[model samples]
Target: MTDPLSALEAAVQALPDDRTLRVRYAELLADAGRHGEAIEQASVVLREAPEDEAAKAVVRRAALAAAEPPGSTPAAAPPDDRHEDIDWSELEASIANPTEPPFVERVVAEHDEELVAEAGETAEDADPVAELRRETVRLADVGGLEVVKRRIDESFLQPMAHPEIAAAFGKKLRGGLLLYGPPGCGKTFLARAIAGELGAHFISVTLSDVLDRFIGESEKNIHRVFRTAREHAPAVLFFDEMDAIGAKRSGNTFSSFRNVVNQILVEMDGVDSQNDGVYVLAATNHPWEVDAALKRPGRFDRMVLVRPPDDDAREAILRVHLRRRPIEGIDLGDLVRRTKGFSGADLEHLVTTAAEKAMTESIRTGSVRPMRMDDMRAALKEVKPSIGPWVQTARNVAEYSNGSGEYDDMVEWLREEKQL
Candidate 1:
């Protein structure tokens, strides 16, 4: 049998000094899983054009392909090695240094639906060679937000599980969801839970992961994320703090951001794209800032309001936080009533504060003491629901700025809570 690769190799040798030809050859080798040869070809290009960002990318990608064992998504999404190709030093001074808030403040190991105070490594530290499947965080683990969980089951999970039935009713298997609510309200956790429900891989995209200081790279980064999800089919690609990346493009001085938004729109539902098993989920504290075009029909089409957990959820959140702790005779009912309107994070903080009180008492008595109702009340006096301020802002938006009634869910919830 004639060897096509050998012919290509001969072509590379014939024009060994042609960087463009060698680059094409490298790409073909990498795609064919001939990553070792691909790496060698890319190295040759880098030797000639050391500053070539494209060549550097070939090297990074080829090395990544070579490291993969057989067929499995790599544990950590590779860094934007394309960033290595461009020199951002000159542009750093001109680019206004917008302060980026932390993506994930901390991690805790799951202990029977409870977020035990156990610390763990981030995604970057996960095993690259190991199978990518890890335990999915189901809705049960979520500290409350029963309404949000039901919506996900009805709107998202149902569609995912019964694709044929959905298609018969004119629903496409692929789509995007935008979960918007106040900070620390378990939006990110809900997205993970949704992924878990479907038994799909979840990729949480961040502004830092997509936006680049160099030109055009932001768009490429977005493409790379989606491509990764498609390769690992039946996957959920989530974007946290999405408003920052998908902001309204109008009147934006930076065309680069506009370009990134445009890229996202195209990727979500391009005519030539096949996103069948790739579900898109995005979380944002500020959905109002997201581009109107993104919410039109195909991209981020449906928006879900993730309000603070109700009393039941508060108790659940409290139980999860106080489970392993030394807590005795704590009245959950009274605490839930007092902690009304608190988000899940607020509830966790409430428990933590109460524990701190117990520790202080122990420090004086030289003996550990179980948390008590008094400690809970003392913490409640100091720490109020953080959702109140955010809810106030949301109220105005829901009542006044809801031109299309998209914020109806949030508005209804507000009215029911008497906060409207």
Candidate 2:
């Protein structure tokens, strides 16, 4: 047989710059265990057409093929109706290109309607957590929420790192975790960081994403969310502000929301531990608003509270927010003490407003200078905590404590500051 490297070189030389031909050549090279050459060819194609869907599809296929055990055959092609592995841009081009061949044209015609409709719906109702997860930033990028971070590492990250240990004990590795706290307390940031830690594809679903005007479409969308997660196993499925769809059904409430919640419960319960390598993580400010059924043992079994920052956390948050800026005579420790009730988000806004004020002063005086202590102090006076209402609501839900005994430090701080 001819060497795969020689075959690839000949193919590339014959159809240089042709994205499709290059992709096919790369795949064949990968199958023949010439990974370096295949990667180089794929890289060249990607550089030329950064948004080339066909090229990306080829790269994914080739990488999977190259990773297979020696003598093992490549996996079968995914079903035609499945959009999970479809090259979205290639599908679009096929639909738009008038001169495409008959078979290609027929496939496009058959799938385009459903695909386009689904895409349109998804675009219209994009989940905020899903959007956040796409960025996939390291844990260091997020400021504050250290306690929550440790809990996440202990719960999700540790299990992911040692899946065999978890599996050997007959524990279910796939399930959901609930992060409940005030908004902007870094719940979404932790979710993204978890995805980064696990190296998993993250898909965010929301109440708006699944809810629809059509009678049965809402349930169908819920099914699609889990189905997509299963297709992309070892994936993180995040639901932000879960209260919207996860609210417990009350006697006087509308039946539509109830049905949607029921559908979600059923789908979540049906996820098999072995087959579906999915991790569902949800964030909500109002844990009280979540349906009782959803919070039960089998569904979102683990609930981690991401509360407002403590003194040390606040100081850390301040330092991170001020890292890029030029500041003078600012005592972060004192600032942390003063901002007793401030959330991580509140501190960020405080820093931003302070910088703006300093810039305005500099422009007025015609002198470019770093922010002064007065600028930050003035901003602190104006930027009040946004979590007061949520705090009271949380206190009203169940009790002021879950008896974890870890929040004594925060409680003591609140007492010292006379904010409890």
Candidate 3:
């Protein structure tokens, strides 16, 4: 029998410099246990035809071959490593056997669900909603909202569990709670965490999914949101960025949007006093933009403020994001202090950008190690904080915060910092 490596070598020697031939040659080399040569040849092909799917396919195949156990047999390698030659057999087998999807796929899938639910699909159709609802926000992931979480658990979650006891006195179970804060401050994430703690379905709705080009479509979408909630009773309906559809209607604007806002007001009001076991959770960066009628007593009675992370919260954010990364002798407390006024999202980005910078530097210097403090400091120079603009808008809105009025703290913080 002919040796596979010898056959592969002969094949590579026979091939021309054409992109397709090079790709095939690389695949055969990889399958024949010559990964180093395969990688080198694939790299050349990729540099020449960066956008060639066939070339990229060969690179991926070469990578997997290099990763395989030393003694494991290589699978059949395609001549032209294109999508046409994708090992459907392997993919289908994995899907049937059920291994975890790649990390990128998982993240992309989660984001896709988020985008869909935000457009206002029923909770039942949005499977990711259920998954998000199951994600409990550990005190660590929440950053610096200790006081807020304590109040919420004590005031809302605990009370709702024992509604009969509350009713025996004078208190009744509330239908909804609204969380308003600056963008990227973790409002959506907090709502998901709440749903997780409650062991309920998290249905996230947004204006994009509900609003329609056709007349009367918006109202119908609104009905569908509520109707689905009723069907999946005892679920949490989380409306993110509610201002888009729930905005206060100016007398000068088109009546169509005004009517939709009015319909939301009516539905929210209708849900009150009804113990159908459905809980309404809403969040917005622009609370002042919401309709006055919707903020009335019966609609969204309990409003919570989800402000940017304070110093302590920033530390927590840094820790959470850096958990899986390689770090040595890094002072988290110092980072937090230096990153005052940063949001949870900002901290995550800071860590990621720093790691990327370090990786690039390592590649250049032939170093295979985690990023150091100097690399992080360099990234900080490039990644500015996003909270400044948010704090200003929050202050302006706080001045007019009539209902619940919980955003006063955020406003005060901004004022003290002279950022408002």
Candidate 4:
């Protein structure tokens, strides 16, 4: 058709109540410079489905485009949405611009409006674990970390997945384990993997997901989170960025903060409360900041240190990012060798930066060109591993906090890696 937008507009007129088709129509309208109409169409969906984060994104972009100069380019939409790929930008970056405000957050959409009408699962809610979308993230999906996977299988995953064996072996089926590592080292990703491994619903709570201002609200949130998991037996409730909520209370004297940590302890105690099938998973970039009480037994007792990915894992990560994009036969081995210290997140950015350069070339020549090795080589120069400072901070913690041997795993790792 000569005018796809016009044809789509007519189709929308025919099926005005078709929200799905309207969504498609709105995308075309935004592309056709009709931001106002696009905004209206997207708002209709939002009113009907408030939890649709992508619909919210469409509205935000339409509003931004309407306010900007005519013919100005809109920010790039997040990549790899059609598949089960990671868009750190959408999960953590903004669509209006990667650097801009109101970042697109990942909210697991509800399949049936009346069946379970809630934003996300909480520790308090009866079915809190049922709220988050459950994906099949196998351990194989994790690029590297054979050792970490084995450790988790023994200490965390196998126990939860096989309760009969756990009970027979005098092991506790329901308990918490902590995943501590540098940022973007795939703690959240591993949590999802555990959920997939167990074939259970997953509820992941971040600092942004749970903190409250008024007195007792945060504690209430914590109880609700655990209760939700308990209600949905065989569920995984992951607390991300745990340091923010469970920071050490010794040097710092914030009564409210201490209360939150105490509440976590109470909820994790399966003796008073029957927590048979619920699995508690938590992750932190700054383990030292986490309250020592949280590290005790029956709580987040077992700690798995998620170090930087090995060469194979890094190569696997690079392949996933490059899979959907237009690219020539780039050398994955050479890329892996050269980018020795690159984290998964860094590799994602490296591929994105490379793709952006190829896109710029396409725009310049009016013809699409596949990404080349040179584009990647240039991007490699721009992106560096962002893990040095985090590891250094962890080293300091190991140095000062070894009296209790709580950080012995970290100390041993630093020693082996010669990072001490």
User: How accurate locally, in lDDT, is each candidate?
Assistant: 0.74, 0.69, 0.67, 0.75
Q: Candidate 4 regions off by >4 Å?
A: 1-130
- Which order, best to worst by lDDT? 4, 1, 2, 3
TM-score of each: 0.68, 0.63, 0.63, 0.68
TM-score of 4: 0.68
Return whichever of 2 and 4 wins on lDDT. Answer: 4
Q: State which candidate, 1 or 4, has the greater lDDT.
A: 4
Candidate 3 structure, TM-score to reference: 0.63
Q: Candidate 2's residue-wise lDDT over 1-420, tens digit each?
A: 997667767877987967788887876766666654565576567545545655555545554555468789777535446647656545433322122112111123434456557667533232212232343686666666666678778876787668799889877667678887778778877887787777777887766676643334456667677767776777888888898768777731333456668778888885443325788889988766788788777678777877787777788888988999989999887898889888888999999999999999889999989987899889988999999887665544434544654334345434554656
lDDT tens string, model 4, 60-113?
556566656657766555443533464433432233222222212224444533
> What are the per-residue Cα lDDT tens digits for candidate 3 across 52-145?
6665555456556555676897665656545685664354223221122221111246666676689696432343222223455543456668
How far out, in Å, is residue 86 in model 2?
Answer: 48
For TM-score, candidate 2 versus 4, the one ahead is 4
